[model samples]
Structure formats: C-alpha cells, structure tokens
Target: MFKIIDLNTLGLGQEFPENIYFVLRGWMDSNNIIIKGDPNVIIDTSYCKSEKETESIFSFCGMKPDDLDMIVNTHNHADHTGGNNKLQLLSGAKIAMHEYDAHYVNLWDESGLNLDFSDWELPKFSVDNILTDGDILSFPPFDFKVIHSPGHSGGNIVLYDSKYEPLLSGETILNGDFGSVHCFREGNRALFDLRDSIKRLAQLPIRLILPAHGGPITNPQKCIDDCLRRINILIKEPIKMGYHFIRRWFIHAVLIRGEMEREKLFSHVSEIENFYAINKRYIKINNKDLFNEIVDDFIERGVLVDRDNRLSVINP
Candidate 1:
C-alpha cells in the first residue's frame, strides 16, 4: 500500500492553499503528488511497473483508483507515465499531458514515449485531453497553468500556480540533479531546450517546486541556478556528461532489471539510438571504451557496491 503524507511533513514546512498530499515511491518509480478535492487529481501514477501492481493502485491517497478524476503526467518518461494505461482503465479518468508529448502516447511510438528504453511492461495508453501551454486546469481550491517545459523530453511540462507560487517541475529541475541529457537525435537541441526552459522558469514567481523525480524543492531559484551551472557543464563537456549519463542510467537499468550481463549494456543502449550519436558526435569513442570509462566513474561514485563483472545496485 502507498503511504500518503502531508506536504509539510514531507519537508515543505509551509501549508499550501489546498489539500495537497505526497506519496514517496521506491527508486523504481517516481514520487506522486495527490490533490484531494471534488475531482481528485494524481500528478503522476509513479511507475505501475507490472500489471500485478495495478490491482492495488486504488489504495493511493485514501481514494479508490476509479474515483480519480484525472491522471496528469509530468512527462512522457517511463518512470513518470508508465502507469497511465492501468490507472485510466480503473478510474476512466481523463489522462492529460502536454500537446507536444501526446503524439508519442496517441500513436504508441515506443521510442518517443521512452517505452523502448525501459524493460518494464509499459502498456500503451491514450491521452484523453491534450494539455497545451497556458491551459488552466482547476481541481477546486487550486488551479494550475500549464507551462510546456521541453528540455527533459520534447513534451515535458511544468504546472504553475501563480496565486500560490508553487510549480510542478517534473524531471526538469530537482533538488540537486536535473534530468539526464543524452546525445540523442537532433544533436544537442534537447540540451538547448533544457537551458531555455530553466531560464523561463527562473523568471516565474515560484516559491516551491514539486518535481517528479526528486522530493519537493522549496528553494526553486537556487535549484534553477544550479541547473543552469550544470547545463553549462553539460554543454561545454559533452564527453564527461556522456560518461556520467551512461553511469547514472546504468544505475537505473541495474536497479530495475537487476544484475544484467555487463556486455548487455551495449545492445540495450543501441536501442535508444542516442548511444551512437553520443559517440560519433561528442564522445568519439567506441561503446566498449565508453562502457569502461563509465564503470570507472561509477566505482569512484561509490554507488556501485558490486565490483563484479555484472552490474548491480545491491550487494549480491
């Protein structure tokens, strides 16, 4: 069962203008922000992972899954939107995401939806309503204006509350870390978009940031500044960024799939297309070389407990 806690207790000391609840999720899934009101809205379903977990999703936020009026996805990433299909089926809730991102979901494009990247059993889910920039969605006591923040992915969005000064930042801006920027197709357009999106949010009157990945961010401005500095580093040093990206994402892959064959990473990342682009355009190294580089980086980071040939986040 998912435990729902008050936002204040979850580290946000100040009370918001509405009844907002937070759910802490495992590393395999994203955290959730629930708005309990006339029409209950769950910001993200976290990651349903498998169909078996869907059976008990109704227990979230003290309401049955079917009672949920809306399932708002912060982005199209697998961790963020994997549960869309099952949740919608239970609640018949109107699923909403940025208009730009809706293309992947509506068309069931595995690559665009990031479904190809994850080994999870992510079912294709349709978007009931397309959320465009400036769209205002009200869930009773509070209303949010949609901000199309397309740096993390082409369709990632930030929900802004002008009156309350809080915004749902998704994976774009986190406590100390931002989303992983890979050298995918379009070259470095995603990188540029991330910079622009952060700059745009910096201009907003934001007091708090509710992100999809990390826990809630109270000091959004400082976080945005840190994101800009990190972006500069990423842009200036794609080689190092590439190495780090592989390391972090590999940690994720190992965490979810569990102790994958070390060599399998080459084939797995090949499916993402960006791996080739990273090597050809920026890193200028073969997959094996890059893999070795990332392994060294991971060891230095101490997140790698198992120094064996296989990659694992836990000690075996």
Candidate 2:
C-alpha cells in the first residue's frame, strides 16, 4: 500500500531540479504531476476543486503560475482536464492533448456515461499543440515517449520514460487491472481495444506506473501480468465479468450516499448505454430484464443487500 502523506508536510514549495512531484489529493484522488527541469512541465490538472490546491503545489515546488511551459493532458476526461483553462490562464502555458481528445477538451461536455459532472463546470480552452503516438517529449534529463492506449477513452495516451523508470499512465492501465471499458459512449467502451492496449503496454520496460488515481504502482510487471490474467478470465467468462462490473459501479454509487433506493440505483446504472451495449454484444440478451437480474445477482452474491426497496453495500 502507498503511504498517504500530507502535502503540506512534504514542503513541496522547496526547489529540486530534475525531480517529479505528485500532488495527490482532492476529488477522485486526482494526481497532478510536476516535473522540474529547464522547461517545467505539468501532467494532468486534476478536477476543478483542485485548482487552488494545484496552484499551491506549484508554488510549493518554487514555481509560479507563469513558470509552467506546457500542460499535457492524458485524455479528455473532465476530472483530468477540469483545471486546464484555469492553469492555462494563470500560467499562460501551452495546452496539448491528442487530436481526437482535443475537441472534448475545448468543449467541456464530452464525457463517458453515468459520470456526474453536475458539480463541475469545464471551461473551454484551445489546444496549443496536438500530440500523436510515438511522439517524444524532451525535458532536459528525461525524454518521454507517448504511447496511445485507448479503451478507457478514445484518445487516452501513456507517457513512458525508460531512463526515469516512470510510466505516466492516465487511467488506461490502473495498478491491478485496466480502467473502466464500459463508458457512456458506444465505441468508447471497446473491450477488445482495451485488451490490446494492455498487452502492448506489458511489453514496455516500466518500473513505476504513476496513474491518475490511487497510489503509484512500483511493481509494474506484476500489475500488468495480473491485469492480463484477469482479462483472460474475463474473456472466457464475460457474464461474470459483467456482473462484477455492474456490481463495482453500483456499490460505488450507493456508497457515495450510504444507501439508495432500488429504483434509483437501477435508474442510475441503466443510464449508461454502454452497460447494456456490452451486455448485448457479449451475452446476446435483449430487454431490460437483465438489469434486474444483474441487481438481483449482486444481492445474491452478498456484494449488496436490499431492504425496504433500498440498496446498499454489505458492510464488512
């Protein structure tokens, strides 16, 4: 387990040339990376709520708003790009993302299904540069090679710096498994492409995986191998995979409120068209009955409990 350290105690405002600092806090456990070099670089700006915190972090690293040279976004997700406009305005740094994802970054309303973006407002911004696969970004002592890893999102990319031994992976490759493939959009939840992307990443010489969420993964190979093994099993037993997927998100939504009405839970999960899309593609099921079945399945498996028409996670 990664130790959760208080950012204030780290004295991040101190200067350390040629070092990477992680600002991991706020909503979604958002991680904003600061790379100290000749042309200082920041990766993923986290959510809107983290704007002030991110600014403080930059100051802690002895960097002012205008000190940023470039802001690289891993994808178009709101949480990752929410602070883009603010940071750009404050630092006047050039914003860069994949061409496919650039549109969403500038729009502020393009996200996957079932995600509650009501609390945040994405400000429109222009892309200063467009990044593509195999692109090499030079930051003095470190050179990061961009790898386009789609599945979680159409334009997701992972940055690899072998010499530094850190893979700046967004949400594409999590520590133990691939990020969510069941998105709101139809083609966005492409499981096959996600599997291929994971396989491609496994071949890389990655020592550390700095993900957008959770803790940084030190045992890169083991995480990749475990993810692959899990995917293989999921491929063979898609229904079980689907069950776990639904259950995972279902519990997450409910846990947010401690408990929720059964109808409300079903309504929320059913909103993601990709959920049924994936199910229909794999299970060959038709109709809304499967949604109920999945909910009942979760209850039966003891992953959840239902009482008085309300659903909640089974507390351990």
Best by TM-score: 1
What lDDT does candidate 1 reach at residue 145?
A: 90
lDDT, candidates in the order shown: 0.73, 0.69
Model 2, which residues run further than 4 Å from truth? 1-18, 26-29, 106-121, 183-189, 241-316
lDDT of 2 by residue, 43-109 (tens): 9887665577667677677788778989999987656776888988977889889877876655544
lDDT of 1 by residue, 203-226 (tens): 998877877765677787789899
After superposition on all CA atoms, how large is the RMSD of candidate 1?
2.9
* Each prediction's number of clashing residue pairs: 0, 3
Instruction: Write down the TM-score of every candidate.
Output: 0.88, 0.73
Deviation in angstroms for 235 in model 1?
Answer: 1.8
